[model samples]
Target: MEQTPLEIQLKTLPESPGVYQFFDREGKMLYVGKAKSLKKRVSSYFNKRLENGKTRVLVGKIDSIRHIVVRTESDALLLENNLIKEHQPRYNILLRDDKTYPWLCIKNERFPRIFPTRKRIEDGSEYFGPYTQMRTVRALLDLIRSVYPLRTCNYDLSEEKVAAGKYKKCLEYHLGNCLAPCEGLQDEASYHNQVDDIREIIKGNFGASLTYFRHRMKELAVEMAFEQAQAIKEKIEILENYQAKSTVVNPKIDQVDVFSIVSDPTHAYVNFMQVSHGLVVRSHTMEIKKKLEEADADLLPLAILELRERFNSDTRELYLPFPVSLPEDLKVVVPQKGDKRKLVEFSERNARFYRQDRFKQIRIIDPDRHVKRLMQQMKTDLRLSEEPRHIECFDNSNIQGSNPVAACVVFRDGKPAKKEYRHFNIKTVEGPDDFASMTEVVHRRYRRLLQEGESLPQLIVIDGGKGQLSAALKSLDELSLRGTIAIIGIAKRLEEIYFPGDPIPLYLDKKSETLRVIQQLRNEAHRFGITHHRNRRSKSAISSVLEGIDGIGEKTARDLLRKFKSVKRIRQASVDDLAEVVGPSRARKVYESLRE
Candidate 1:
C-alpha cells in the first residue's frame, strides 16, 4: 500500500501540546483544533470513529495535516482561538459578536478628560472598559462628574497656554461644572488628585472617593461654609448610592472575574462579569456559533481567554462554573458554595438570559433557523439518530375507569400541529388499565398512519413511566416499527425519561430546552386526553339517563337535550314544555320517570 500525504505528515507530527489544522487536497483549510498533544490528538481523528456527522465529513475531506507545536496547552488554546478568528475554518465555532462595544477612555492629556467612546486609540491614555452597554458608560460618567469637577472641552491645556491665558473660561466654569483648568483656576496637582480618585472609582473602588468627599465636607464645615459642606455631602451620598447598587457580594471579594456558559446545539453564550470590591464593574455576554459538536469543557476555556483579552481583565482570581485548562497566571475557582458560587450562578443567569433573548429574536426574525436548531438540540439530547421534526405524544385519561380514552398530540417542528391531533376511545382495553390502553392507542395510531400512507412522527412521547413505555414498545414491536421510530416515556414524578430495554432513565436539566419541549408534549397530551374523556363522560351520562325511560329513544333524548340543554333544565320544565319538545306521549313518561 502506498503511503498517503496525510500519513506522512502524521508521522512527522510532534508529541508536544499545540494547535492542529486539517486541509483538503485543494489546499483549503477545513478545520482547526487545539490539543494537549499534537501527535495523539491529530492521530485520533483517523484512529477513532467520529460520532458527529459534521466531524466525520470534515475528516473525510482531509488530505493533509498541519500543526504548530506550542509550549503548553494554554498557549495552544490561545493560538487555536487566534487562528480560528483570523482564518475562520469551516469546522470551528466562530464568535458571532460584531458590534463594537463602548469603552470609557481617560485621555492622555494635561486635563485628562474622561469620556465614552466606541473607537479605541493606541495613545498613552488609559481605558477602563469595553462595557456591554452605553447606558453603563453614561451612568459611570455621570457619577464621576457629580463627584469631581473635570474639564470636558478638548483643548491644549498646557502650563504655558494657561500662564498666557490663551483659553477663556466658558459656561462650564460659570455653571461650576468645571474648575477651569485651561485658565489655571485649578492646579495640575489638584486636578490629578481628583483624577486618581476617579480612577479608583471607575475600578469599582469607592473607598478613596468617599474618603476624599468626607474630608472635603468636614473641612468646609469647619470653615463655616454650610452650603459648600451640604453640596459635598450630597455628592458623597450620590457616590454611596451608586456603589450600593453596583455592589453584589461580600466587599472583601474583590478583583475577581466570573464566567459562566449556557449552550445549545448550535451556539454557546458565555457571560463575563468583572468584580472589584464586591461590585460588578463590568458585564457582557459573548455568543459563539458552533460548527461542530463541542462540549462546555472545550468551549469555556476558549471563551475565558477571548473575553479576558477583549475586556482587558487582569484579575488573578476567577469564578467559573467548571474547571478548565488555562495558563497558570490565572486562578480558576469553581466555587462549590457560598458567595463565590452565587457570583458564578449570577453569571450563568446572564448567559441563560442572553441565550433566551437570542432564541426569541431568532424565532421572530428567522423562524426556520430557530426550528432547525431546536430540532438539532432535541436530537442530541434524546440520543436520536435524526432530528425530531415531527413529534407525537400519547396520554391515557380515565377517572375511576368510567370513560377510558387516549389523546395523540402532534407537534411539527416543535410547534403544535392542531389539525393532526388525534383522539382514541379505548376499544381493545377494558377499564382504566393505562398500560393496555397505551398499547392499543399506539398500535392503532401508527397502523392507521401506515395504512393511509401518512407520515409517521420522528419521535413519540408516552406520558407515563416504565409500564406505559413497555406497553407502547410492545405495539411498536408488533408493527415492526421498534427500531424505525424513536420513543420515550416521561415519568411525572421526577420527569425521568425512560427508553425501551433501558432500566435506567435519563434526567435532563430543569431549564433545558429539550426537557421543556418534552414537558410541553406531555402536558398537551394530558390536556387533550382529559378534554376528550370529559366529553365522553358527559355524553354517556346524558345517554344513560334519558334511554332508561321506556318512551324515550336516542333521538327523543337528543331532542330533549337540544331543547332544554340539560336533564336538570328538562326536569325544571313543565309537562307543557316537555310535550313541545318530545310530544305528549313521551313527555308524560319522561316527567313521571324524573319525578320518581
Candidate 2:
C-alpha cells in the first residue's frame, strides 16, 4: 500500500518533545496532542491499532499532520494545554471551569496594605494564595486584623512624609484598628515586626508570632507592667485559636503541592491542595471535559502545570496519587504510608466529592440533560428495548362509590406533560370499581388516539396491583395492542411493580431514578383524578339542589351555576340579578326558596 501524505509527514517528524495537530480534508482541525517524541508519537497513530472507537474515527478523518518541537516535555505540556484552550479541537481534553482563583496580596512598601486580589502583577509584592473561596480569604484577613493593629488606608507612609508629619490619623486610628503610622505615632521597628509576624502566619507558620508575643509578655511582666502583659496574653490566645482552626495536618509536612484526579468516560475532575507547614492554605477543584477518550494520566500533568501557574505556586515538592511525567527539576512523591499518604487520600476524596457535586449541580441547572439521563436509566433498569420518552400513567379516584373518575398523566422525556394529560368521567363503570374504571379509561384513551391518528406512549403505568394491570391488559387486547406497548402496574403497598404475565413483582431500589419517576407519575395522576372528582361532586350537588325547585330544569340550573360561580353566590344574588341569569319565573322560585 502506498503511504498517504499524513504518513509521509509523520515519518519526517523529529524525535524531540513537541505538540502535534491533525487536520481533515476540509482543513478543519480534528485533534491536538502532545508527545515526548514527535516522530514516535505521530507514527504510532498509523502503526498502532487504537482501542478507542472515537480515536479510530478521528484517525480515519486525518488528511494531514503538523508539529511544533519544544525544548522539553514540560514545555510541550504547557504548549499543548494552551493550544487546546485556544483552538478547543474536537479531540483534546477541554476544561469547562478554568476561572482564576483569588490570591491575598501584601504590598511591598512602608506601612504595607493587605488585600485580596485575583490578578498577579510583576510588582515587588508577596502573594499568599489563589484560595478556592473569597470567604476563606476574608476569614484570614479578619483574624489578622484582630491580632495586629494594621493600617487599612492606602497611604504613602514614606520616611520623609512621616518625619514631616504630613498626614494625620483617620477613623481607623480612633477606632483602634490602626496604630496611626501616618501621624508618626507608631514606631517603625514595631510596625515592621508586626508585618513580619503577619507574613509568617499567612505562610501557615504561627510559631514565630507566638514566640514573639511570649517573649514580650515575659519582659512586660518582669518590668511590673501587668496591664501590658495581660494584653499580650490575649493576643497570644487569639493567634493560637486562629492557628488551631487552620491546621489540618502535622507541621512536619511543609511546603508541598498535592494533586488527585477522578475521571469518567467523558470528563475528569482534578483537586489541588497547597499545604504549608501542614496546613491547607489553598485548595481548589477543576473540571475538564474530554473531547477524546483521554485518561487521568494524560490530563493530570497538564492540569498541574496550568493550576500551578494560575495559583502562582512555587513549591518544588509535590505529593500525588500516582507518579506523572514532569520536569526533572520538580520532585514527585507518591506516598504510600503515614501522613503523606493520608494527605493524598484526602485530595482524592475531594476530587470525588467535587465530581459528584458538579454532576448534581448540572442536573439541577440543565433539565434536559437530567431527563435524558433518567430516561436512559429507566430503559436499562426496566430491560426495555427503547427509552420510555413518552409515558402515560393511569389512576382511578372516587369517594365511597360517588363521583367516580380516572386520570391519565403523560410524561414526555421524564417530565410531566401537563397539556397531554386527560380526565375520564368513568362513563361505563358503576360505583367505585377501580379495576373496571381503569379498563374503561385505557380503552377510551387509546381508542381515541387510534381513531385520531395520534402518537402513542412508549410505556403505560396503571396505579394498582395485578388485578388492575390485568384489566388494563384486557383493554389493550380488545384494541389488538397487547404486547406491543410496555405496560406495568404499581401496587401502593411496598411500591411493587407487576407485569402482564409475571406473578412475581419487580421491586426497584427505593432511591432509583426509575422508581422516583414512576412515583411522580402516579402521584400526579392521583392528584389530577381527585381534582376532577371534586368538580364532578360539586356540580352534581348543585344540579340536584337546583332541580328540586319547581320552575328550574337541568340546563337552567347549570346556567345559573355557571353565571354565579356557585350555589352560595347564586343565593346571595338579588332577585333582579338572578332574573338576568335564569329568567323571571325561575329567579322568583329560586329567590323564594332561598328566603324560605
Candidate 3:
C-alpha cells in the first residue's frame, strides 16, 4: 500500500500551535483552521470518524494539506482569523455585518460637548459607546440634558477673549441651558467639575453625581434658598430614575463586557453588551456569514476585538456564555448563576431577535440578493457546475387523446420570465404520451436556440420521473448537448430529483429554498401548458362545429366566430342577427344546425 500525501504531511507536522489549510484537487481552498497542536489537530480529521455530514464532505474533498507554524496559540488564533477573512475559505465563519455602529463622544475641548458619532479619530476625545440603537443614545443624551446644564455652542473660549468680553451671552444662556462660559460667568474649575461628573455618568457610575446633587440640595435648603433646593431635588430624581431604568445586574459586577452568540447553518449572530456599574451602557448585535463551518469559539473572539476597538472599550474582564481562547491580559468568565448569568441570557435574546429582524429585512429590501443566495444553494445542493440564474422547465398537458401540448416556462434569477414562455402543440407525439411530448418540446426548443444562436439556460427541469427524463436525454443526445447543460427531472408525487445516468434520486429538504424554486418552476410550467391546452381544445371544438354545416366554408365559419366571439354565442344568436354578419343562406344553416 502506498502512503498518501495527506498521511506524509501528517507525519511531518510539528507538535506546535499553528494554522492549517485544506485544498481540493483543483487547488481551491476548502477549509482553514487553527490548532494548539498541529500534529494532533491536523491528524484528527483523518484519524477520527467525523460525525458532522458537512465535515465528512469537506474531508472527502481534501486533496492536499498545508500548515504554518506559529510561536504561540494566540499568534495562531490571529493568523487563522486573518487567513479566514482574506481567503474566505469554504469552511471558516465570516462576519457579514459590515456597518459600523454609532458611538457617543465627548469632544476634547474647553467646555466639552457630547454627541453621537460613527467615526473614531485619534484626537483626544472620550467616546462612550458604539451602541446599536441610535434611539438609546438620543434618550441618554436627553436624560443628561435634564440633569445638567451644558453649553451647546462651537466657540473657542480662550481666557483672554472671555476677559476682554469678546463674546456676549447666547440663547443657550438665556434659555438656562448654559452658564455662559464665554462671558466669564462660568469659571473653568466649575465647568470642569460638571464635565467630570458627566463623564462618570456616561461610564455608568451614577453614585458620584447623585451624591454631589444630594449634598448641594441639602446646602441650598440650609441656606433657605427654597427654589434652588427644589431644582436640585429634581436633578437627583432624574439621575435616580435613569439609574433605576438602566441597571440590570448586581452593582458589584461592573466594568465588564458581555457576549452571546446564536448561529444557523450559514451565518452566526453575536450580541455584545458593555456593563458599567451593572448597567448595560452599550449594546449591539453583529451578523457573521460562515464560509466553511466555523463555530462560536472561532467567531466570538474576533467580534470582541472588533467591538472593543470600535467602541473604545478598555474593560479588562468579559462575561461570556462559553469559554474561549484569548490573550492572557483579558479575563474571560462564564457565569453559572445570579445577575451575571441573566445578563448573558439577555445578550443571547438580543442576538436571536437581531437575527430574526435581519432575516425579515433582507426578505423585504434585498429580494434579489435573497433569490441569488437561493439559486446558489440550489447549485450546491444539486451539484451543478454553475448557478441556475436562467432555468427552463418543461411540462406536458393532455386530456385522453384529444389535444396534446407542452409548455416551457423560463425563469431568470428565480423569477418568472413571462414573455419568454413557449407552448408546443406536440406535432410528433400521439395520444397522451408525456415522454414523447417531453422529447419533442425539448428537441424543438434547443434546436431553434442553436440555429438562432440564442443563449441556452443553465439548467433544464423536467416535470416527471425517469421515463420522461430519459426521453429528454434522447433529444439532448441528438443535438450533441448531452453534457453541455445541466438537466434534472422532478417527480410530482415525492418531488424527487433525478439526474442523467444516476438511478438514486436526490431528496431535498421540504423547507429548503432550492426545493421551493424548483417547485415554482414545475407549477408554472404545468399552469402554462394547461392554459394552452384548454385554449387549443376550445378552438378545435369551435372549428369542428362551425365547419360541419352544409353551406359554411372555413372563411364563413371564421367570420361568424369573429362576430359572435364563441361557438356558444353563435348558437344563441338569432338567424337575423347571424345573417347581418354571415349572410342569410349560411345563417339558416347555422341556425338549423343549432336547432337540430
Best by lDDT: 1
Residue-level lDDT for 141 in candidate 2: 93
lDDT of each candidate versus the true structure: 0.83, 0.82, 0.81
Deviation of model 1 at 52, angstroms: 58
Q: TM-scores for all candidates? A: 0.56, 0.45, 0.47
Model 3's lDDT to the true fold? 0.81
Candidate 1 on 206-274: residue-level lDDT in tens?
898888779989999999999999999998888877742232344357689999998888999988887
| Cα shift from native, residue 162, model 3 (Å) | 85
Better candidate number, 1 or 2, judged by lDDT: 1
Candidate 2 stretches with Cα past 4 Å from truth are 1-356, 360-368, 581-583
Highest TM-score model number? 1
**By TM-score, is 2 or 3 better?**
3
Please report the TM-score between candidate 2 and the true structure.
Answer: 0.45
lDDT of 2 by residue, 1-596 (tens): 75555645665566777678888999787888889988788888889889999889998999987665555675465456545655678776553236444567888887788898867665777776545467878989988888889998887899998889889899888898998989888988999888888988886679988888899999999999999999999988877776422224444677999999987555788888887644455556788988787889999999999999998999999999898999898999999987689888867866765565555655555567666657767887777778899999999989899988899999999889999989988888878788888889999999999999999888999999999999999999999998778999999999999988999999998967689999999999999999998989988998998999997899898899889988899889999999998888889999999777
Q: Residues 335-432, candidate 3, lDDT per residue (tens digit)? A: 99866897788778667655655555555556776676677677888899998899999999899977889999999988899999999998987688
> lDDT of candidate 1?
0.83
